[model samples]
Target: MNEDVSDGWAASAVAWIVEQGEDGDYGRRFVLDAPMRARIEGRGFRNALDVGCGEGRFCRIMQRAGIRTTGLDPTEALLARARELDPTGNYRLGRAETMELSAEFDLVVSYLSLIDVPDLGAAIARMVAALRPGGTLLIANLTSFSTAGQPDGWTRDGEGIPRFSIDHYMEERAIWVSWRGIRIQNWHRPLGTYMTLLLDHGLQLRLFVEPEPAGGDPERNAVHRRVPYFHIMEWQKPA
Candidate 1:
């Protein structure tokens, strides 16, 4: 893992905690949570490892759904908040690039965390290894199109409507972004890069989703109706 990325998260962890607390923002509360929970609630997963589990929000949710969850993150401040949220819960200080747990879990989730991780192949290899045979890996992330086409980079045409400006999207690039107080580095990797990394390990896609806003600020979520902002994918390890 890159030390810069780790340092960046250390700085941003507090603001991230605050954002997670305040209605989970548009993506978390309105779009990602429901569909993820739907797939998780009824499934019988004995144990789950939430990799890059900043603040342990998803771990707590999974615990409520009866899955024994372990939250793993590198940021100390975030882990501290995660511990505060669930005093008795398992929140470990580790990154996905190098994680070893007591045992493999039936479910492993990386929710919007991979963007910060520099080495997708290394990080995900560790993640896949942490899963038991036939286990599932669920990833919720910004699609390459969204990551490559940042609002700041968009150019307006004669009509003043923004048009996406993309260059070298296939090449991995570290892009920095901040909103409110959350400042961090997000990597932009093409779709094929992610697919090849997972498929090379023999994981098979079980479910894929691009969720829409449940119902809230129409203006804030209006773009998602036209283009998918986030994608959720479930991959199963060979049985």
Candidate 2:
């Protein structure tokens, strides 16, 4: 992780906590939570690790499902808040690139957090290393299309129809974004970059899905359907 990325989250930690109340934003509540939980349900996972687990929400979810989970993040403020909320839960202060664990977890998850990682190759290596054989690595990330439309996410034409534009799709760089007082630098990489890294690391792809919003405000859902924002992937290490 870049120093600026860590600092950005530290500064915006409070705003992020407030933005993600008990449930999460539209994406998590409607598009991700159900499917992610479904994938973990009855899988007999003994323990899990949540990388970039901001505020420990998913960690708590795993705990409720009887999976021992450890939440790892670089931001101390977020980890502190997570500990405050779930006093007994395990929360570790560390970056994914430098995570010091080996074959220790049945499942490792990256929930909409991969974008913030600057050295994603290193981070992915560490995440794969942390997983036990046959373990699953679940990831939810913003689509490259969505990230490509960084500074100007969405615009409206004369007809008042929303339009998403993309350029330099193959370029890998950092873009600063802010919303609801939560500012951060998010790294953007082409879809192939992520796929190649996971495959090169010897992870077998189990599932690849671009999940649409299931149910939400009709207007918002319509917009999301037009330009799907997120996708989820399930990869397994050889046993």
Compare the candidates by TM-score and give the number of the best one: 2
Give per-residue lDDT, candidate 2, residue 54: 90
Clashing pairs in 1: none
User: Top model by lDDT, which number?
Assistant: 2
TM-score of each: 0.93, 0.96
The worst-scoring run of ten residues by lDDT in candidate 1 lies at: 1-10
lDDT of 2 by residue, 1-239 (tens): 45544548878888999999868888899989999998888889989999999999999888888899999999888899899989999999999989899789999999999999989999999999999999999999999999999879898889997789887899998988999998998988999999999999999999999998888899898888988999999999999
User: For model 1, how does the per-residue alpha-carbon lDDT over 1-239 read when each residue is reduced to its tens digit?
Assistant: 54444447877877888888934767889899998898789889889999989888889889989999989988888889988878999889888888876447999999999987888999999998998999999999998888887636557889999666666778788888888897788899998999999999999999888999998789768767766779999999998
Residue 50 lDDT in candidate 1: 95
Model 2 scores a TM of: 0.96
lDDT of 2: 0.91
